[model samples]
Target: MLRSDDLQVFVLTAELGSLSAAARQLELSPAVASAALKRLEAQLGCRLLVRSTRSLRLTGEGELYLPHARSALQSLVEGQQLLAGGKATISGTLQLSAPSDFGRNVLLPWLDEFQLQHPLLSLRLLLADRNADLFRQPVDIALRYGQPEDSSLVAVPVAAANRRVLCASPGYLAANGSPRTLADLVHHNCLRFMLAGRVHERWCFLDDRHRELEQLVSGDRVSDDADVVRRWALAGRGVVYKSWLDIAQDVQSGRLVVLLPELLGEPTPLNLICAHRAHLGERVRLLREHLVERCQRLIQLAPFAH
Candidate 1:
């Protein structure tokens, strides 16, 4: 039998052209990855790869064995999925990625509940504001905001009612007074956040006449982390434009107050993105549905949830 690690090391080394890169992707040291490949070749009694400092190329045996190894791996994964499919209890690691704020505030507890329900299942979550490369990264699932840029990925809508909401803490509002109009925001402290690498100073909204409005608002404070921005808002630092799901509890509990009630924020989608549709197990599909259903309920419960 081809050991899973050996098979993976061979496939990844061939695909990535660098033993170090494949090793890092698998969270194994370069020494271990090299040893695994050597073990595989020793067992097969053939040289599969020609390696040098600059490059790694597959030999004739590797060229022939590559497809079969990949196919075999796929088969094993599918068979495991089939065995676990629709079972009352499901088991296996579910690797997921999400935005930092959403992952910490919203998805963390939700995942906890999921974990409790399926004790056999394991979870690996990576939280970052930037989108993960599904092909290179080990993540099997990701939750994100807005349109998925990668055309190759399959995006499932977790919720369509996602709209930005302008909020400020009660103390800040008391000190700075609520803005009565879009023009009024310029005078107020409008907190800014950075996504990826760009600073998001421009905010979009619909005016009372149902016309689109965009403003490049500035503030005394800025942060790369959305959670930091939210915390600042909660601390009465400044007004922030953010998704309703993020500040639902704050809005409901009166920690933050929604401003400019008549103006509607632009729509953004909350999506469940995956690399491809093939071999997606029933567990993944169920989890998608579960998120959508729960998010819908949360939107319903949130006082001013878009």
Candidate 2:
């Protein structure tokens, strides 16, 4: 039988693509990760990884052993969950990832309340705009906007948000003149969000007959950061197409106005995603439930009221 500790370390290292990254996730040193891998390889009498200064690659022998090791680890984890006393009491660290703006405006405030309710539990929250790889990153759960592309991860729709609308400060609109039609957008400066080498310069709208109209927009300013785009709009730099949750305050306060609300299309979904662990732990389950409940309430409360 393989040592559980060694198996755990090996699996983590494989998932993370590097021993150092795995060590960081496990809160261990790089030397410790290397030693554990060496021990694991020694016990099996086969080299599992082709290691280099920069990256790790699994050997053919290692690939064959990986599935079995993963299954064993999962079974062990599930067994522990079955032995846990009850659902009411859960203790462990729950690592989570979320978009920067959502985490700041919506999630961070509720965390205090969640912590107060479950004093034994700890949390590690990573707020980023880009999608975090749960399998590679060791995150227990992630709050994400839009459907998850990874089939391996389980996604639960936690909330819903409308697609971005063209918005600009009243001052800017007054100076540049509000667009009367979709075609007029070409004449106005449009702020864009560039993600993964794709710039969202084409604005999609609908006519009175509900027919789709695609407008190609251009501007001098563009960024991947939603907050940055919102700021630029607020500063009267250009018209921004932003998520409603992101610009709710500006809209409510009359600082910004939705340029073409009637033409805006369907709402996009927000989801809570997690790696498909064989045994869903009590802490993970509890946190998932808590987030779903809180998000529901947040949607109803309209906390973005400006």
Candidate 3:
């Protein structure tokens, strides 16, 4: 088998575009780095790098092998981490981001329970309506609604079957009268929220006919805070279209009533998002499994979870 260090030298050299730079990063001398590269190439029976004193570049064979080499290194690192911290002791600060409403209302208690179970684990939670930049932000994972737009991000399902629900407080329906049909929403006060600097006034759902419909709604109140919208709905001020996980307890407690159960709501599948699969360490995987169980239980308990 090829020495892992040699593979590292080659990968780092390809990435940094300098054998000397790769050597500096690995704390190896220039000669040793060069020798490692030669050994790696010799084992593969190909000239991997076109080298000169002025510049270095990968040959076609080197370009093809780089990704595999990187994957091998990453696998090695993951295996080491799994063995070192995967057991009874999980000691690390897990930084996470989540939506303001779900984070505060739902996820907070669950995380508390998780921390209680793993006493050595520390957590830093950021609750905001806006999505966190996994590449730039300090957050290691994010609990987000809907699928990520950026295909590069890894989205592991926490609640894949979760969907939005149109709901209102009993008092609100009693006073304003219930909307019997999709067109009747024009007469109702549909609560709205702002995200990514835009007001989400269009409520999307499937009609009784199973056709996709987008209802442009308006209300007297609007806020960027999602909890405020749910609160407004609870206060009987307006109707809300929100995730079932966030409002399941409210619905179960008779604080809010699901509307238009005949019409299918837009899918808002929740996911634990990360920048790469390598970020799904043992802790993250365990957390995800925990959430999946909790979320599924809540969804099943609700009157109209779908």
Candidate 4:
């Protein structure tokens, strides 16, 4: 029979991808963690990992053993929770990552409510526009905009937010005149968010038939920050294509106006992603459900929720 301690260490090592990380998590020395893994492998008569100075890769045997180890650990945790009964409350740290703007305006407020309900749960939230690697980082969950392409992590659709919209200040529109069609945008000063390294300045639009139209919209001013783009539009610099949520307040305040609203497209789905563990704990389930519920409420009241 596989020892439960050995199984726990195996699962930790697999999840963390390093002996030192697993050791830190388990509160064991690296040497002890390595010894435990060696012993576990020796007992099973199979090598588990291909270790290098910079990286660790699971071998065929290691991959096969991973699911079993995770299952054993999850079963143990569930059994403990069952034994604890009503006292089995979630009381651990949950690390989350999200875009800076969404984190500030949307996630933080909902998190405040979630915290009030679950006072025992501690949270570590990181706000960034860049993609976070859950396998490399110590984050438990990440809220990502748009659909995720990574198959390694499990992604759950939490909310749907409107996509990029083309808009400008009323003053700018009065001077440049409003674009009547998609082709008219090319002749106008289009502010674009250049995702740091991309060469092309392409903008996508949806026609009345719902067909996608990709155009090379040009402008002298370009930035990656949505706030900066909004500011530029407010200053009457040029037309900007940005997320509706980022510009909704400005639009409502009349600091900016949606130009060519007929050309805008459908919204993108917001996803909450996490590493694929064998089983999800009650805390994760509860938090995920809460976020989904909150997002639904927001969608109903959202200005662009058409």
Candidate 5:
């Protein structure tokens, strides 16, 4: 029977592409990591990897066994989490990837509160506008907007009623009157944010007759970070199509005003995503529940919900 530590070292080495790098990540000596992998190969009676002075590659046999090894480790993790000796302190690092704006302005506070509750648990957060590669990235969970098209991921809808609210700063609205109609949007300076690599200049909304409308709105500025767009909108730069949860406080505070209530924009799903089905763990489940409850409150803050 191969030790779980050996399996862990093997997986980390494969992912990081270097035994020494994996050792450093695991906080183990390079000699120990190399020895563990050697022990694993010895138990299986085969060389699992080919190593040179400066390179290492998995052998064909190693490739065949990799998936099974990964599956086994995942199962062990799930079992440990689920079968914790009653009331065992849930302590481990939970790494997450999130969108820039929501992560900073929203999730950051929630996570801080959670950490306070679970003083033993460590957290690592990566904030960015781009989607993280769950299979390759060192992330346990991800918070995302919109439904992911990939069938490989498991996504739980945390906030289903999140809609984009058209908004402009009071200063901008006073400087250049608010849009009263969908057609009026063309007359105002629109703000845009980049998604996945393309500029999302085409704003989506519902017409007065409830027909879906897509407008190719142009803007004087565009940024990959949604927070920047929000800032620009607050600074009276231009009109912005943003999630109500994102701009609710600003709108409620009267810093930003909603525009064209008749033109209802589409709702984007807020999801908590994971790469594999490991039942996630007690802490992750509770975290999901906490986020759901919090997100529902934010969703309720929306001035218009359909």
Candidate 6:
């Protein structure tokens, strides 16, 4: 029989590319980690790693076995979670990624409340403007706006009705005046943000006849960080096209006013996304439900501009 500890050691070492580093992560000594690896090899009757003083690399056999090892570990974990009644067994670290604006202004407090509910669970949050690569990065889940372009990933809708809204600070509108028509945006300073290394300068809208309209927009300021653009708008620098969920509080509080209330802005539904269906543990399910409720309530509170 293969010991779970030995399997864990092998997987960690393979992933980290350092036996000592894996041991440190597992809170075990280097000797124990080495022994576990040797014992695993003895059971498998093959050397998994080609170790050297300078580096560690997987052999051909190890390369073939690594995916199987990961699958086995995942299965074991899922089995444990299932037997523990899911939510009650949610005890491990839940690594999540989100857009910087939402993560700080919105999710930070929500997660704090969630942690309080599940005292046994731990959380690790990564905040970035770009999409997190679930396969390459250590993130387990992510909260994102707009439909995922990757068909392989599983996306659970948190706010299907959510849409992008054209907005500006009261101060900015006061100084520069408001855009009454889609064409009027070209005359205004439209704050822009970068997505996937490209500046999102094209703004989309729906006409009063429900026809699609596209406008080429530019601004005095641009930022990769969505929150920075929101700040710039708030500072009376330019107009911002943003997710309604991200600026709900600001809009509700009368800080940011919605600009073209008649025309429909582009839909940008929010989703709780993960790389695989198997990764949807009980904690994720509960968190999704919690977020759905919170998001819907806020959406209801915001003035419908689009």
Whole-model lDDT for model 2 versus the true structure?
A: 0.74
| TM-score of candidate 1 versus the correct structure, residues matched by position | 0.77
**Residues 202-228, candidate 1, lDDT per residue (tens digit)?**
899987688999988999998888888
Give per-model TM-scores: 0.77, 0.70, 0.72, 0.68, 0.84, 0.86
Off by over 4 Å in 6: 10-18, 25-27, 38-89
What C-alpha lDDT, on a 0 to 100 scale, does residue 259 get in candidate 4?
70
Poorest 10 consecutive residues of model 3 by lDDT?
Answer: 85-94
Candidate 4 residue pairs in backbone clash = none
In candidate 2, the residue pairs with backbone N, CA or C atoms under 3 Å apart (3 or more residues apart, or in different chains) clash, namely none
- Per-residue lDDT tens digits for candidate 3, residues 169-285, read 999999999999877889999899998889988888876677998889998989999999999999999989999999999988999999888888888899999877766776787
Against the true structure, what is every candidate's RMSD? 5.8, 5.2, 7.8, 4.9, 3.4, 3.3
How many angstroms is residue 52 displaced in model 1 relative to the true structure, after the best TM-score fit?
11
lDDT of 3: 0.85
True-vs-predicted CA distance for residue 29, candidate 1, Å: 16
Q: List clashing residue pairs in candidate 5.
A: none
Candidate 5 local lDDT, 1-306, one digit each (tens): 889999999977876789999999999998999899999999999987898879998887877666556657756765676677633355666778988989888888899888887787788899998988776566778889987778888898888888898999989988999776777888889999998789998888887788898888887999999999999999999999998878877888999988877777778788888876663666677788888899898777776654
**lDDT winner, 2 or 5:** 5
lDDT of candidate 6 over 1-306, digit per residue (tens):
998889899888987889999999999999999999999999999999999899998887887676556556756876787877773555666779999999999998999889888888889899998889876565778999977889988899999988888999999888888888889998999999997789999989887799998999987788899989988888889899898889999998889999887777888888998877767767788899889999998888654532
Candidate 4 has its poorest 10 consecutive residues by lDDT at 192-201
lDDT for every model?
Answer: 0.82, 0.74, 0.85, 0.74, 0.82, 0.85
The residue-by-residue lDDT of candidate 4 on 18-69, one tens digit each, is 8789889899998888888888999999988878789987888887667556
Q: State in Å the error of residue 90, model 3.
A: 1.2
Error of 6 at 167 (Å): 0.5
- Name the 10 consecutive residues with the lowest summed lDDT in model 5: 84-93
| TM-score of model number 3 | 0.72
